[model samples]
Target: MEAFFKALLGEKAFLLDNNSKMIAPTMEGKKLHNLERLLLHVHVIVEEAEGRYIMNQAMVHQLNVLRKEMYRGCFIVDNLKRQGTESNNYKGHDVSNSFILSKFNPVKRLFLSDVDIHRETDLQQVIDNLSNIMEDVNGIVVFLNNYPPLYRQPYSMHLFIEKCMFRCQMEMGRIMAFLMQKEDQGCVGVLPIVGPTFVGKSTLVANVCNDARVRNYFFQTILITAHDINSENISTLKDGAVILHQNNALDQNNERLLAIIELSGDIDVVAWNSLLSSSSYLGRVSKMIITSRSDKITKFGTTQALVLTFLPLEAYWYFFKISVFGSIDSNDHPELQSIAMEIARGLNGSFVGANVTFSFLKDNLVAQYWRRYLSSFREATQRNVSLFRESPYGLVCDCKPITQLIRGDDEFAVWGRYHACPVEENVPMITMKDVIFGRGNYEGEFDVLAWKSHIPPYNSYIVKCVIEKSK
Candidate 1:
């Protein structure tokens, strides 16, 4: 709970006003009370050990207790005890907020006066008592006990991840390669850069969008995430004046599609076809980018796709040096730099973790430090994964698979296993477990792994994520 709370406590509070002052206390106690109460009834004991560490007899037992008491967001069945609802979803507050309300209540209590408990935020009154309010609230901090999937970076983040790793997808790249070369800019629609989950489709397109030079060219760049490929709620994303052609889209209409394609006036051929079919009016204008973790919708014929590969060790060295220590010409740490680059090469295309490891190395580090990092990087991550996925410690539960796309057999084919590789500041030397961490749920499931690598059947575009799995 403390760990999650810390991860959430950012420099600026999202719930604040223009002056950037927090305005509410919204009691998470109610949510926590409900979960603990449920646990107690089920004979699941939560012993408060050292450092607020919770010790329960069995996780399975805790799961059972959760099953009975879990309200909206955790399970499909609505928890009757709290809000008298039939389905698992809570009636009002979004699941994410409910989670924040529950997990951070500990540190939140420290800033109780800042929280507007009764829906009314009287900032002026609290302002008058600022000294009094801050007296009891001497810096509330959350030590690292856990990390939410947010820290994993979105599966779509492969876009940036690819730039750092240099393992960019060519399906989107080829289209850009063509568009940049040709005289004609194609129609404006959601250019479906279809590929299996974790296959670099989203990452590739996102990188192009993220490029500081190209980001403003589009009216809006949105990545819609869904648990299932086909979801009706998907329409809500396009309600505003923005583009919404990614993620689940079979259910979307030509109208929503039109809203997006028209928003950007004109675009390239791939995007034009995706947002609006050649059949629609505005769809005729060109330029759009679409990347899907699943083939929820089907339109337009198949096109050739270029599979992305890992960055060369040489590229990793340049990125690491510039991103961390900011220069490759460091005369002070030539030996350390050499060892760091070697370790970075071993990381494949995982630039994030490589960066983290390198940052750790910038300190009083040498051969011993490098060796220790190599020995423990993998284990630390396995432990971290469990912490990342550790359900909202009751108070409510909602689960979404961490999206990962390993290029299966279908070249340019259509994707888990959560996670690609670790993103640390320094390139930690890792062993077998680190590889296992990257391989994730696919371990021992050879057929699934093989099927993931198979790319022949789709006859469609396949893209790979930033990190590469050796297997």
Candidate 2:
């Protein structure tokens, strides 16, 4: 049969093997095609799951697993595509190791230890894993339709991405399930959310509280900050707390209350007990959510604690790409996309850093400006890591100064003890953008708006900036 086909087709017959199966020119091409298909399948499944108003505990867990695999697949495909571009631009160059190592931060190294960029078998294994996950998701898709649909207002894709929670869908679903569940009489549910500083613990609680389903299910919602908890006695906490949502129709004793407490550190045993004791006065069947940076607070929860960590490198890159190139096709500008990937790697999964960097990069679409920004950012990051053994972002979280050479030989010190104020309050006119890009002329220390949150409980972050004189 092979001889006959070869004779009939001549040279073109080389496209088929002895078995008459069409041959792929390269394994990379085949993997890309498979990854593209798998990505589409996982995306559809995730979208369907997200649209459902309710999901059982098992369904939520399954969806979470599927979503994570989808992120991993995206990371692999993105790296492959970027490499393709580089290979096309410069033939016969071995840049795989450096390119792959650039994406491996502390968090990514922990999760992606098995993935070897140089090994074809490892890449094939990731694709195979994704394929297996798709088979499992088939069962989830069938049951997704049984759940009711949620009504959401129409918004542009970029706006929706900016406003909604990024990758916390499963956590949100779990919390929603906990809130809507029926409990025995006089049994108040306590949920503790723990994470590192600025890991979106407060934002998560805020988004959950703002959900229409959560708001309607509970009669009243109250907010207690660390200040409110410390300044006022536990008994008077009710009076001092800010009522976020209240339904007057429910009687005082019968009201279902949700109290969201934000703490900077761990709460003492006595203080926690007193707070729980005081919750009775609010209503019956109350739910308390405590958010803190300390894992020690996890002991206060009635159920398992929800711990949040930095987003995986692949997932963070996905978000960073969307935010930086809003309504712009990245494929059209391969060079800029490459530069953006380098910048994203330097960010170390810091959402605030991504936002601030994108805010500046979006203003200037030229390659020169982006290259300059990436250069300076890399220098600052290297300096921070060398001096403090931490990334600039890590230093910022610890409220320590980070050094930056914004332009020329001029150096500047950015104090990390930034203050966040409600949107209604007035903030400094000079913003981080102005300071970072050398837009403003300031003599001494002054506060500048770092970044603003677009979602509920909107806040403006203000950081202090000081100009360092050259020695």
Candidate 3:
């Protein structure tokens, strides 16, 4: 907001007229001049607060008020300038014509006196009032700085009796390999974990970070939270701080560092650019683990990103059961176990959904209650899945099996060749739309030939082809 007001004032280049000035030079245009000076001070305060990452509500409120006032001041100044310009253009033309123009644009003449305080005494009074507000602002800044930092409550996953990280070993290994790769030395190796929210990108990263190989490999491991990435944040970063150009010999073992940058969907492009630019100054090897819902954003400067996959049926059941029963067998709670399995299947590979659902059932462990949950599970899951589908949270609720090319209503208009692999195959008879779109209601009872391919060179394109036997 402060930045906005500063830019506006800079662009307008407001000045005072000598003819409109007071009789004496000392008393001339004092109020408007003081307003300009006060606005600059307001900009500086806001900028400083932002630089220091001050998020106090009181500070924000004060700054917002100042910004709005400055905005109004700028608007008034701008309107006056425009009116002056129009007045000059009509010079020697006609006084009646100018009056007509002012009538047409009533804003030019209307309420001018409301904010017009250019007199020496009036300006001095306003400036004194504004200057007093500056003392309040300074006090707010000091109060905010003295306030204690608030730490986020730790997630329940760490406290869970049984961590449900089943079937993620392969994913952990894949990401671990990327981090420990011998290639891409001297440059920061970026490994982006792109998935939907609550799909366990952070969990996967956490598991991999704790891996024996990864632990030994990186000398310094820093975790950056979801803060706006700017030059100041990067320069003042304490954890995972990479000492680049200068001798990074802090200890005898001068090993490279790894910085894990975790953020939700809202990405600041300018701040990220600044952070990346600062990395060039570092001398030693470094790696960045970036997590984002947008695959395009995460994989911006990387060869490939690890897209997280949900667990298979058996794996999901095991994961969910542990969260609910804590190493107890399904046979022990046979009455609710069947319904629990059904619930797990309906979860559609969402670890978040599974955890939340099972957590609900954990305390209310009754067959009748479980049955009631099972009955409405599909509808509830459907709504949840649909909501996530519209936004790129992660993969869909259910995996589109790799066996067949699922088509939608408007898919195929003509005979086209799709490379599932290098092999050529014929897909005939059915309209592409029917095959793709018609699969919505049809549950998979049997396997069909399906091929998944990534386009070469950049490997950015995903092509899936499903061939069903012609009836």
Candidate 4:
């Protein structure tokens, strides 16, 4: 059997040689090392770009493209390492029935092949991509010093990532540029940001509005929700809107207002027209931002609408991997890394789900615990897919109820009616973590904290949940 394997593998047989494993690194291991170095280099460039106080639109666009390449490289390298580890284990074990292997999609299964001819090609492409991005950004790095630096407290990469927007830099840059534009003497510029539910539209807008540059530009920043705009008193929008920021340094007569309107559905035409006319009370040079899930809002924008979508799968895995490992090195826990990739795939790009799952997994680093979580997660996802013909992510997006198996036959039914409350306001002590991981016994209907935003508009997401007995 050994002779036959050696004949088939030829020069690659060194990868299967257990004796050489202690003395030499495998081909995948070497690629991972090279990729890590490239990732670090790209990260430094991206971080420097992020620190500059101002960047031209062209530079911002370039940096955004570079960021995506960095994320793609990370995903490829991580998956390569994961496949390598699994391949070694499969040499002596029969893992054909493994849940992890069974759950892989067609594309993913291709990565698990014994003789993966595309692995080398994929790794090389990632390396080349990163190297090209690094070369392209060298000029941008040189010009970065021209812009003033924003004063920020020193923070680790993970902490910075945790506290700031995940992958909305481009959108933020566009909005900032729009806000700073010199408007026509008597015109009010309208910029509409459109996205689906729970896609970070509110969070993105909140962060951009809270920026120092934006705050210094606009004399007053107001937040207007659908509730604030009544069809009966459409003209009263100026009075009913919530004041987010006010700059007393600016002259009252020359003050410019930044109005952010949040909508759940399509706005009535007459009410919108009346609202636009009523904005004359604020100032002519003032600008308005409309954020809505409906695409109809695009017509209201003076410029092209800034569309937001969930992060790409590769980008999301990088985000999830960092959130899960935090300051710890993922290389130390190869088994956990494989489990994490599976869990991330099961999440279907849900940011809140990533935060919630990572918070729990970070505390329990054991392989057994992680495997259990993955098993339970897969089961819950399959159950939802079978019953509703939708995944958990789809249900969450639609604001529909999702089931989480608690213990044995019991389940936690998370209701669709959920809302975010200010941090200062009263919030539920019970969290989704407690219920999902079976931390405590609870009964009847109660509110559960789904996620708490650490960034601007620091609000806690509360979901109505009920305990159902027997499935």
Best by lDDT: 4
For model 3 the local lDDT of residue 62 reads 68
Alpha-carbon lDDT, every model:
0.32, 0.72, 0.49, 0.76
| Tens-digit lDDT track of model 3 for 1-56 | 44544565455334323322432334334455556557566645543443333334
In lDDT terms, how accurate is model 2?
A: 0.72
Cand. 3 TM to true fold: 0.41
What CA RMSD would candidate 2 show?
Answer: 7.6
Writing each residue's lDDT as its tens digit, candidate 2 over 1-471 gives: 224322544443242233123224577666666566666667656755665665577777778888777777766666665655644532343323343355554322322333335646756776888888777765676677688765355333355468778888888987887888777777888889998877788888889999978878889999888886642477788888889888776676667889998999988887877777776655563688899989999898999999999897878877888778888877567767876876776677887788788778986788767766765676677667767877788777776888776656666665557667888898788887777667867757778788898887787878888877645
TM-scores of the candidates are 0.33, 0.84, 0.41, 0.86
Give the per-residue lDDT of model 1 (tens digit) for 1-471: 444333433322232122212212234333333333232222111111112222232432333223222211111111111122212322242323332245354322321222224212322222223323223222222221321222343332222332332323223345444333322444333344554433345445544554432333333344333321123333333342334333342333322222211110113345433334422333333344444433433243234323334344334444454444443333244444444443443344453345335445655455456544543432232222344532111101111222222333111111122232213222224322233334343232221111111111111111122243433
User: Is 2 or 4 the stronger prediction by lDDT?
Assistant: 4
Candidates ranked by TM-score: 4, 2, 3, 1
Residue 98 in candidate 2 has what lDDT?
Answer: 44
